[model samples]
Target: RWSEIDIDNAMWTIPAEREPLPGVKFSHRGSKMRTPHLVPLSKQAVAILTELQTWAGENGLIFTGAHDPRRPISENTVNKALRVMGYDTTQEVCGHGFRAMACSALIESGLWSRDAVERQMSHQERNGVRAAYIHKAEHLEERRLMLQWWADFLDANREKFISPFEYAKINNPLK
Candidate 1:
């Protein structure tokens, strides 16, 4: 929803519960952890969202269903789209696979801390004691930088593909 996005600040806050809007039928029970997740948007993300705002309806949904303007897209929508694009969703890649692919790439890059990347992925520590100790560490600044780098890396390799390790060797931002 538009209410969750702060375009000016380059931030997207995924609330724990959906903020009810008049006339909207669906209520999204936010993240899996039942906690608000702050995602730092990259420049590319902000640009894409700015363009999407032009198509946003009165209900403030960024991506609504084709059949019903008031409702968000169904869970299978993305997978269907991917299948149409010639990908075998079952064998090749599904919607959720993108998350795993990105997480793997981010870890392979070796530029970001594990904590920052996991937090960015909205993953909570499974260990109760560890979760308690590190609960306050948002790592927002590091995540912001990491996300921007990830965007840049993707943009740079969009036309000519290279492995993350090879790309890091050539264009290590820290170096």
Candidate 2:
């Protein structure tokens, strides 16, 4: 929602508890982990949001349904778009596949730490004992740099494709 976006700071805070819209019945709306997720936006993301702000309605939603302005877009929206673009949603790629693809790409790049990537992905530790032992580190600064790198990588490969391994080898700032 627009309320979550902090364009000036290039951040988006996904709240742990969100009040329902008027006439809606949901008690809470938030991340699956029920923890606030901080997303460090890249310059490209901020630019897109800046453009979107011009048409933002009083409902405070960034992306609303075509039929109902107060509600979110349908879950099938991205899948439908992929179908229009000649992708087989069943076999090739679905909307959720993007997350897997991103996760895989980031890991393959070897430029970011595992902690930073997992934090950015909002993945909670699956092992109960491990979760108890692990520290709750946000890794905000590293994520900020990583996300910017990701954005630049995407922009660089918009036309000509480059493998994550090759790109990382050339652009690894940690070196």
Candidate 3:
């Protein structure tokens, strides 16, 4: 039961790379459409997925329960996790907020070009190119690296006191 869904879609039957988006259909190209539609997984995503896979048991569904073997999970589960973490789920604080916070931080950090950052988040870029290309990365590998860095930066700053002033102070102490 859990021996599936290493990478699957809603039904958890097909790899996301091979399956079509739900409720949408086309000719034979439909399934093939998924290939170009993937945002490259970031190193952080990879690491998380890897750990989940291990926790999932052999062939375990990433979202399924081995003992119960039911549907993966729901937003409620996410909300519950938030609540346990003392997050204010009653307010705007929810799971997806991580993306918003990340995008804003990235744009502010200047480590990522605005376009690349949006692509990482699957958000539309400022330029019109985003409308035409959702998952087709013009620079896939570079974007992957940038995404990893973004994740690492967030982790690094999660409980840190260093600020821009500190960085400059350390790097240019003579100044």
Best by TM-score: 1
Model-by-model lDDT, in order? Answer: 0.87, 0.87, 0.52
How far out, in Å, is residue 107 in model 3? 0.7
The weakest ten consecutive residues by lDDT in model 2 span: 20-29
TM-score of each: 0.92, 0.91, 0.60
Q: Write the per-residue lDDT of candidate 3 for residues 1-175, one digit (tens) a residue.
A: 2322233321222222423323323211312233333345555666667677666644333665334433344436787888998888778688778778767766665445666766555554556765566545555555655655555665666788444334333333123
Worst 10 residues of 1 by lDDT: 19-28
Model 3 TM-score, 2 decimals? 0.60
The true-versus-predicted C-alpha distance at residue 172 of model 1, in Å, is: 3.4
lDDT of 3: 0.52
Judged by whole-model lDDT over C-alpha atoms, candidate 2 comes out at 0.87
Q: By the TM-score metric, which is better: model 1 or model 2?
A: 1
| lDDT digits (tens) for residues 21-121 of candidate 1 | 45555465787677999999999999999999988999778888899887777778999999999999999999999889878888898888899999999
- Over the stretch 111-147, how does candidate 2's per-residue lDDT look in tens digits? 8888888888999878888777764888999899888
- Distance from true position, residue 40, model 3, in Å? 3.7
- Model 3 is weakest, by summed lDDT over 10 consecutive residues, at 7-16
* Local lDDT at 59 for model 3: 30
